[model samples]
Target: MTPRLALADMAATVSSEDLSNLQLLLKAPSKDAVRDVCLQSHRAPSRRLAEATAATLGVPVSQAAELVRSLHVLSHHVLFYNLSSPEQILALFPESFHSSLKNLITKILLENSPTWRTEAVSDQISLPQLKDLDWRVDMVTGSDSVSRMSVPTCLVQLQMEDPCPTAGGESVSTVTVELSRESLDTILDGLGRIRDQLSVVAGK
Candidate 1:
């Protein structure tokens, strides 16, 4: 059997070291598939193997996150492991990854190296955000009754105090939201849609 099939068949039963080795040997595209098989086949997936596999691959940040999420090994160290370039790391990873290390010793790392992407350790070393946040107001829409605004990210909730009240005398309009984990592709697609919408609005 090819490395892929062998991994799929034995990924669940394989030891953590062997599983991680198998993942590194297989092609990048096949890694997620093997991960799925292992998840379904095992009651509890191996965090050690999952973290190892994630550190080896160089796909988008969203795909790397899914592996950690599936294995329930969400951590600052595991997600950012073996990556390069602080600029690239900050761009690729989600905001949650940033928030995770915000309170830790990342401030010290920033002071020392200024850019340390690969040496992300939870207890001893923390990755800091040295770059400035560039937040652009993508869209703004409002009505006499209620207001609405959207950014480049998905249709997430943005809370603010409204001055006006609804017909029901409710000052706040509660929007029912069902949240799910978004992939890198999903975010990029959302941004593309926002860009097209902006173009149409501007008569371009």
Candidate 2:
């Protein structure tokens, strides 16, 4: 029951003052909203602005930063379709914004990812506030690092340093993510019918 679509839902709640800002943030070639807030206040990179924004949004400053970051990804089709992960979505939102949806979101990520084959995470996190797990995912890929949310502090991460791709003879490089044995077992009865599971999730 987590916020099904973070951007759509949040966009609706944005106040009139920030409505234009939200438009700019969501517009093509997304701009940094939080940074804009900082510049407008004549305090670039000030922690206070983040804190203030976080307070207003009822989220952590870190999550606020994530919202700005996601805007960039959502604007760019490549990044949005390729790297946007469930962890990133969950991070930019508080627990109240989402119910027990991390598991569902994790599965959705696996279904949509082109990289999970390379990135695998097996870290133990403990967060009571988070309905799912207490973790913070800071993905360190081949080079580009992106996205964040309140989703407790425990992160569900998928890190891939460098995965040699087998796409044709072009020597493509890609970073993929995968849930560990422990995490999968928590939600799945068995991996034998993963396709079937995905079908259910995809509404097929």
Q: Please, what are the lDDT tens digits per residue for candidate 2 over residues 13-101? A: 32333322333222222124333432333212346655755665566677655444443232222222333566654553345432433
Per-residue lDDT tens digits for candidate 1, residues 73-169, read: 2122223342233453344334534343322212222332223222222223222322222222234354353433332333344333344444567
Could you tell me how far off, in angstroms, the CA of residue 86 lies in candidate 2 after the best superposition?
4.9
Instruction: RMSD for all candidates, in order, please.
Output: 22.9, 22.5
Candidate 2 Cα outliers beyond 4 Å, as residue runs: 1-78, 81-86, 115-204
Local error of candidate 1 at residue 181 (angstroms): 2.7
Q: What is the lDDT of residue 69 in candidate 1?
A: 42
Give the C-alpha lDDT of model 1: 0.37
Q: How close is candidate 1 to the true structure, as a TM-score?
A: 0.17
Model-by-model lDDT, in order? Answer: 0.37, 0.38
